[model samples]
Target: MCSLLRSARALATTVSLAFIFNASSVLADVPQAYALTDIGSLGGYSVPHSIDESGRITGYSYTAGGIRAFSWTQSGGMINLGSLGNDKSMAYDSNEAGTVVGTSIVNGQYRGFIWNAASGMSAVPCPPAATCSARGINSQGVVTGYTQIPGGPYRPFRWSGGELLEYLPTLGGSQGYGAGINADGMVTGVSYTADPLPHAFVSNADTQLTDLGSIDGTTSYGKAINSQGHAVGYGADLGNKSAFFWSPELGMVPLGTLGGPNSYAKGINSADIVVGQSQTRTRATGFVWSAATGMLDLNEMLLGDTGYFITAALDINDAGQITAFGKDSYGRIRTLQLTPVY
Candidate 1:
């Protein structure tokens, strides 16, 4: 753990810090009010992986038949995205237009698929004979993910058009996965390196790799990047993992855990606000972080009492809305969205 200090006090201690804030000021640093609207599931878990600028959400859920993809909106509610003639399908990310990209099994081969309300789901474009998965899509409809072509290791690629598949270079490693893409076409993800560590890289163009090394650790996985080129992810430090924020201006800065041994930054917005999971003394908890306020437990930021215990915060939008999963009043996991209220 790092020994960095905040507020003139050491921050790297193993003690849980969720209780560190003074009782009176605990909710003062965050919005005074928050509202929750549970995104109902298909009789089972409704996992949300990403949120678009327009507040559309996409991910996977379990119905009576089997697992299926779903898209959610404030007006329309949850709608199941049928499978690709298989029992498995997932919706990882969506673009501004509510188009989703994720993996599906076709003829027993894993394939990438993109879906929109207008056209439904279709196999995505790829190099000949290559197996692929789409992890992210930008507002302009650009897609980024990994491809496993025969005779070649898995490599990240960007697709602007059907035949315009551009492979990105790795950090001299065997595989790379594209995790996030911003409007400028900058892709951020993990690139396994010759040093045997998963180094994060960001590139606007497909030919070059600008690897973001670990923050005093051997592993750096950049999970999300924003329009400002700010990135957030996690890295290992002294047997403990911690979330991190990255940029040309700040480089890599660790966001200490919630008083536990591990933390992961899963989403970042244009304002540089971050959301993810962190280890508390008892279990993993959702967290929101900002440079000005440091890290705070999401549950603590709630405006009123509730039975839910947020476990993982998967994504956040510039509107200050957060997508997450947690135990509901009945102790069952459920997908939830948090909107800030003035």
Candidate 2:
């Protein structure tokens, strides 16, 4: 009887130890935390829009002259991307080749521009009297954006080879926007249907647009696209906005907020890691989302007391490097880069 009792106890102890080991292994597989680096401004304040694979960042920063586009690197610091003329320029996206695309006020008119080290800022030719802006660019230098025709609706367009302009098809309404492009030349943006409601959409390589329906039937905007053709953005239902991830397999899935009703996903990477801002109980907070983790507050992942909380995560690279905007205790905004610390 004593021997049987001992055997039973031994078996129970072994099972408990095995369970503990498996649980610890699962925890070890979780994502790594991040360390913050404050990339200072050009002058007053700065807002980062995109971060490329090589850690190059492009955005608009306030200079004494005005708001000017800038490209920043770890070694070179911030270099102002001169305007098309003598006005303001705001860079929206940059490709791996260091090509920057954005809109600049040229000769008192808004014109889309493509800039590279070889060629200085050059305006993307548009129809006469039309105001255009380049919002996103891919690895192949394909640019996507919108052109507003005077007395007409905004038309989404794709520019290639610095010359040809391909107008994308609208759902049914007149106004549409091209916000992002992937390495495969797929574009994602917002389009209004016959219902006159804005719906997120993704375009195939053939430029055929597929409407990604909204979460609650109100409005949706596709902000960025990933290598897998997945898109991330925000969808609103009766004015309540929620961050969403749309895939070819799954339609629009809401990424719930951190105890609030509003969230906006702005950037996604090849790994399908999504970063954005969410409204927490107190204020707007930056967040990172993955398949394993639904949403993790970036503030909770800070390695040390960075003295500022991230307000919005604008872009994340394949290396898990995130470019974001942070607000200090005094409400001053600054651009920051958060690198994954394993």
Candidate 3:
């Protein structure tokens, strides 16, 4: 009887060890996510805005004298793309083919530009007396953004192969802004309608606009749209803001905050992983959310000082990498990237 009891105990111990080993192996096989790497500046500070599938990063950097657009390569260092004759420029989005779309101050006014390694930067024509800014560019080089008309409201526009077209008509209000564009040329934005309230909207390729109503007791804005037509943004509910993921199938599903009163979903990748920022009881922090993991604070994942505040997660890629900006201990703003831990 004693021998049998000992044998049973040994078997149980072996099984437990095997289970732990398998679990560890599985985690190891998955890429340990959450690596933060600083994309160095051009003799100044760098703020990464977007990353393509090829790992190319585009953003703006402050040089000794002014801000300039930049593209960072995984192999090479930061390459500066000078402005269109002004002292400041910003790169908003880059396509897979390495083409960058952004806005530059030209002749004392804002103008959209498309930049490439071969041709440098060229102005994208906009309606007369309108200030244009490009927000997103897809693989096909189609750029989507909004144009501010002189003495009037802003209107969304789309540019492809050097031809710019006015997007859907505005919501009978004075301001409209396009935030993101997907591969299919679908655009999402926020506009003020007849009710004098801001509402989220989606525009189809053919220029049909559909209003994506806000959450109950809240105002909403759509930030980013994925290829699957999944849109993520934030809505203020009962004086508190919360992130939300929307689709035709599931409608709007609220992604609760990180134990705080406010959260915003800024980017959504093809895998449905969402990246954004959330405020906790003490400080703000970057977060990644998915169906499996819900919401996770990137600062917690790094085991860093949680007292610091993360302001916003600007973008995320399909590889689960994130780019954001936050305030450090000394009150200086810093750009950071977080790679998943598998």
TM-score of each: 0.90, 0.89, 0.84
Candidate number of the best lDDT: 2
Give the alpha carbon lDDT tens digit for every residue of 1-342 in model 1: 233332122143212222332332332234555677788898798889988888988888888988888889999998888876766888989987888999887666778888888999888777657887889999998889988987788888888857667889889888898888988889999999987789988986546778888866688898999988879999876667878888775477778877777889999988777899998878999998865567789988876787888999999988888899998989988888988887
Computed on alpha carbons, the lDDT of every model, listed in order, comes to 0.81, 0.85, 0.75
Model 2: lDDT to the true structure: 0.85
- After superposition, candidate 2 runs with Cα above 4 Å error: 1-30
Least well predicted 10-residue stretch by lDDT in candidate 3:
24-33
Best by TM-score: 1
- Window of ten residues with lowest summed lDDT in model 1: 6-15
Point out where model 1 deviates above 4 Å.
1-30, 127-129
Task: Write one digit per residue (lDDT tens) for candidate 2, span 175-265.
Answer: 8999999999899999999989999999998779999999877889999998889999999844578788888765787776776667899
From the highest TM-score down, the ranking of the candidates is: 1, 2, 3
Candidate 3 — which pairs collide? 32-341, 32-342, 33-340, 33-341, 33-342, 34-339, 34-340, 34-341
lDDT of 3: 0.75
Better of 2 and 3 by TM-score: 2
Query: lDDT (0-100) at residue 19 of candidate 1?
Result: 37
